[model samples]
Target: MPFIEDFNNNHPTFIKNLLKKSPGLTQREVLLCMYLKFNYSNREICELMNISNSTVDSYRHRARKKMKLKRTDSIFSYLNQL
Candidate 1:
């Protein structure tokens, strides 16, 4: 997978768009997305966020819904906007 080496910090801006469109994602969820979009592997995300793997999964699910990111295949799309 080569770790999807390209990185971007345009997360908050993209999330801002999501917030505008959905008007439902909470500030906590947004922060979680920003974390995932930036750094933290799944395990680390869970540990740092004091949540379980499934909770992280739930965050991802909700994030995709809020952002209208229909497919995980295109995840880097958010990063590219940086």
Candidate 2:
């Protein structure tokens, strides 16, 4: 996964540290959140993860819920702040 390599290239331990703190997020959700943090679109994420569009949306929804974000807040925006 080149994007995973890209993510690691930039953030290093950020994702790893976050995963340690976020017990509610599953592995897929954590990876989705990391991709979202990097400002990748859902379509791109779907392609990278080899999942469907709806599946990407579902992961985003679940990740946002786990993070307790408001519906109006952008998940990527919130993630970037962290």
Candidate 3:
């Protein structure tokens, strides 16, 4: 629980490093992945990113594919475990 707070606070740096390590991911994909890491819903992501819901979905889907994640896998869980 405490680490969640730390992770949330340091998320930008963490996300930056994560994106750096993920060569296949785009900036938008990294942004979406970071939001997803915090368990943000599509509506919340769209609102924060000033994007459409379908755009959010597309980014997430593409991110998942680029990361080679299974469709059933939780992106939040995967990122957190890293």
Number of the top candidate by lDDT? 2
Backbone clashes in each candidate structure, one number apiece? 0, 0, 0
lDDT value, residue 71 of candidate 1: 75
- For candidate 3, write residues 5-72 as lDDT tens digits: 67658864666566665668987887777777778889998988899999898888888888778879
The TM-score-based order of candidates, best leading, equals 2, 3, 1
Backbone clashes in model 2, listed as residue pairs: none
Models, CA RMSD each: 6.6, 1.8, 4.8
Clashing pairs in 3: none
For residues 1-82, write the lDDT of model 1, one tens digit per residue. Answer: 1222221242335655656766787866765765666666889878777889998889878867776776745544663453
Question: Between candidates 1 and 3, which one is better according to lDDT?
Answer: 3
How accurate locally, in lDDT, is each candidate? 0.63, 0.81, 0.77
Q: Which stretches of candidate 1 lie over 4 Å from their true place?
A: 1-18, 79-82
lDDT of 1 at 61: 81
Residue 46 error for model 3, in Å? 0.5
TM-score: which is higher, 2 or 3?
2
Query: In candidate 2, which residue ranges exceed 4 Å CA deviation?
Result: none
What's the true lDDT of residue 33 in model 2? Answer: 83
